[model samples]
Target: MTLKMSGFNIHIVFDLLAASLSLVGTYLAYTWRLRAANAMALGKLSTGYGIALVTGAAVGGYGLGSANLILSEIPMVGRSIVGALAGATLAIEIYKRFRGIVGSTGVIFVIGFTTTVAVGRIGCLLSGLEDQTHGIPTGASWGWDFGDGILRHPVQLYESTAMAVFLVGAVIALAVRSPFFLKNGFYLMVGFYAAQRFIWEFLKPYTSIAGPLNLFHFVCLSLIAYAIYMILRSKDART
Candidate 1:
């Protein structure tokens, strides 16, 4: 579909808002009556994001660029962050309601974050990156010419496939309602994604902000730590 509505191309905003509203609504329904649906977590996630956005905008504005940059070149950042919070919140609530024992409460946050990245990055691809240096260079017969033969990997599709796999695994795992998933699902998917994103980073072109704390390596390390923490905590909780 064309990525324009009227003249303003706010695909990222709409996607984030739509996905968050839809998923949160689904979750509320799943809980039956849409009551006590982690209003606090929702507020906290929004507040956290607001803080990040404001801080980032301030930095950008200081650098002579508008704060809009933080909200640009991204797909569903606001929406997915909220969704992640919702997922994590619902996870703990679900665990309490069904299992009658507390499990790693934050696991769903990781899962939601990963899956949303995978699913929503397509929006980025659709809108196209404004930065010239962001993907693989190509000269083959089948290479796409995004105006400069910057034959980049379809990292979006790659991630989407991985995420679809992760989503299926998550649903199946949840259907079983096994405590193991409640503890380990977040880490497993995140750990796998860390490696995948790390490799994809090489194929990806570097950005002006591509420093030691760039996207690929950063996501990898963070997820690995989260995975390890969840598993370790789950084990400890059992004991």
Candidate 2:
């Protein structure tokens, strides 16, 4: 029942699906950003800004992913979307500081990212144990056997469900034009996602970079910290 290429299998399908969703998300993000005052304000600066942000994020994501691949005995577990988020965030901030651009230019990406992850995880879940996103062994009826006989926590589902909830909340917040959401939506999403991912990492058997914390645990904490800092900064800026 498993599809294969070289030595890999059907997991590639989900991986491809994730990549496709990311592309879709990128397009949606670009279009949605056009409605933002900050986005429009970029004007002639858009080209350089776009290049800087993208290059930075891509470099950061690749660097971190490479670090994981080098350090871990496991294959696919090294790559993480969180690493990309962290990379992108860091790069964007550096670029902004260098160019003196301000305000949350990342707001438009919040929902788009959530949608991408939510859709992408579907592929991860379908990829099952081979994807290395599976949770620790669990006796619960809700657990999925994956390819193994032992039932395990469906961590992929847990993350996907959390993102789905956030997505719904984000949509509603936008519909109502909530001032707080409008002002600091990106920070809110990052903080919320970091919290959820931090919790879920406990279920994952990812190799610990430190004593008990995996590479992602540190990345998640960093994300949470950055989100908090950004949220507070935004609030202060408003006042």
Candidate 3:
């Protein structure tokens, strides 16, 4: 559909808003929820995080560029958020292992990340076929036209809804202080998000990296495996 608003593209507006608000929300969430964690582990958290950010962005950019996904060809700033998340997770795990930092440092980020993705995906939906995030043609009643003649699956909206559900569920888990959930909240979030994304990847009209899966599909599988390992390892450690 032609998502024009007052002579401006609504998708661009949402993208800008999402980026701005997500940054602010992430900072606030970190301060409000992880201040104590930071205080307790004040050993180069900032420096390590800076390194992690750089490495994550690099890895993500490389993945997207190599796979030719969306905007990975535009200089150095084009990268998929999904790739960034996968790379960031790996980088953070490496940093944690090298520094011997223990415990879940990403609890607050669970909500922050989910909320950011949920908001940002609205822009992807509005961008529609112009953006590579659009799904393949479908005949469902809920499918969108996206300025194209063929109706396509609204995968962006599906992901946004999934992220929203995860955010709400995570908050409730924190409020209840579920032992396992609190302990492995980050893993749980990653596992759930990756699982959902893996399913949605099939709907997207992207180049496949393997026989039947795209780059994101492989990334999501890796995330799911890593999350499972983390959860199991945490259990074993407790035992």
Steric clash pairs (candidate 1): 134-205, 135-205
Give me the runs in candidate 2 sitting further than 4 Å from their true place.
1-45, 75-77
Tell me the tens digit of each residue's lDDT in model 3 across 106-125.
66567667877899888888
Tens-digit lDDT string for candidate 2 (1-239): 22223214455665676667767765654465435533543343567677876776677666776676556665443557787788878877887888887777777677778877787776777776666677898878898877658788888788889999998898777766677877788899999999999999888776787888887888899999999999999889878
Worst 10 residues of 1 by lDDT: 60-69
TM-score of each: 0.57, 0.83, 0.84
Measured on C-alpha atoms, candidate 2 has an lDDT of 0.75
Q: RMSD for all candidates, in order, please.
A: 8.5, 3.5, 3.5
Candidate 2 matches the true fold with a TM-score of 0.83
Residue 150 of model 2: what lDDT?
Answer: 76
- Once superposed on the true structure, which residue ranges of model 3 sit more than 4 Å away at CA? 1-9, 23-44, 65-78
- Per model, state how many residue pairs clash: 2, 0, 2
Q: Which candidate, 1 or 3, has the higher lDDT?
A: 3
